[model samples]
Target: MREVDHIEQLVGKLLLLVTPLEDRRLHTDLHNFTHQLSCDRISYSAAALFHIDRSLLTSCIAAIAISIYLVILVEFGLPSLTTSVNNAYGVPNLSEISSYFVCIVMNMYFFVIYLFDIDSTLQGPQKTHTLLSLSLWTGLMVLRLVILAYSSEMVVQEASRTQRLVTKLQMLPVPASSGCQEELLLFEEQLARSPLHYSAAGFFALDLSLLKSFVAAVTTYLVILVQFQIPDTNKE
Candidate 1:
């Protein structure tokens, strides 16, 4: 609860910082004098794909989860973990799929920005710097979450594999294998004692709750795959 409160406080501070940038005419003279550019009606965008604003933060979060979902589908297969859907699934060309999907997703985001006139709200020279700051902060947060998610997943997998290996080792009939079994037991104990985690610049550590959120995101991705009707094929 205290962690949540801390995050809330941080967000409140960021909102306070963004308040000044929201005013399009706030830094007009400064921008013109320093940047030799017009501060009036200046638009903000990222690589010409989508405008930079609060909506961008939401778009980025969605994009990250979608990207993760697509990766899982291509690498781990949908509806099952054992199957690989890369070559045996929809979209004839496996190599170009990612590029094509990225293009489509970007355009979709562009359409959303246009449909809602989000860019019009951010007109001003200072808006660019504001957007950049927000983008940087959001990117860092996303990186932290991704690292924590994957790290936790790896730890879980490793623990399960080690447990299985130890179970198998203990069933061995040969007494010479006793030493190997003991070593496996010790390793398992170590794993149990110190679980894996990820941190952001020594600020905070990711834990089980973050892992749950990551899993939920992955689940949402699966739903997206189903909605898109990801091609499933049999190569054999």
Candidate 2:
């Protein structure tokens, strides 16, 4: 990524000013920097994952951000087409539970970050934006992302279970004379070759892993944003 290269150059210059360093040292120094570059590129590729239509991912992100900053900070929940997890017959989705669990973690993250005195740095008139308002807005945003991600992930999980069943059937001892063997083999092979995972135009899989990466990206950026917003003196 362009930003990655720029950061590497900046770091190299800083190191050079401290002491003389070899070219090899510079090349090997920032392993995590290179890793971050790879992650950034992959995240950019998966940005448009929530929608398949021809809409900009940046616009989608901006909508969520606007909801948090303008709407939820003043109000609470934004109206959207969300499902109530069916509390039926001692059963529902484990994915929904996963989302709920992560939502709790995000809730903790908000409170933990605010322990740095975010409220005291208030710009007078902006004093209305209390800790509760900020946390509520951010927690809602986290819920929005986690809920949708896990819901979409259900499709991929079902397909995997079906594939595993097919695999088990194929592995069973069957007659060599039966014509069904060839069909089972073909189906199993096809499933293996193409694998039934949903994606936004084949960019990446819309599974639980996507949820993991999505949350990670949001958390990382949120930390960076908060760090910049709070002044050094306040942080002290």
Off by over 4 Å in 1: 1-121, 176-236
Note the residue pairs that clash in candidate 1.
90-231
**Best candidate (score: lDDT):** 2
lDDT of 1: 0.47
Instruction: Name the regions of candidate 2 deviating beyond 4 angstroms.
Output: 1-116, 119-130, 171-179, 201-204, 232-236
Provide the lowest-lDDT 10-residue window in model 1. 78-87
CA-lDDT, candidates in order: 0.47, 0.53
Candidate 1 lDDT over 1-236, as tens digits, reads: 34544555555555455545675454453333433322233457766657767776786575466456545543344224322222243243222323433443444333333334444445466555555555565455456555644665576577567667756856654233224444445545544544333333333333456546544554565456444432331221
Reference-based TM-score, model 2: 0.39
C-alpha displacement of 43 in model 2, angstroms?
65
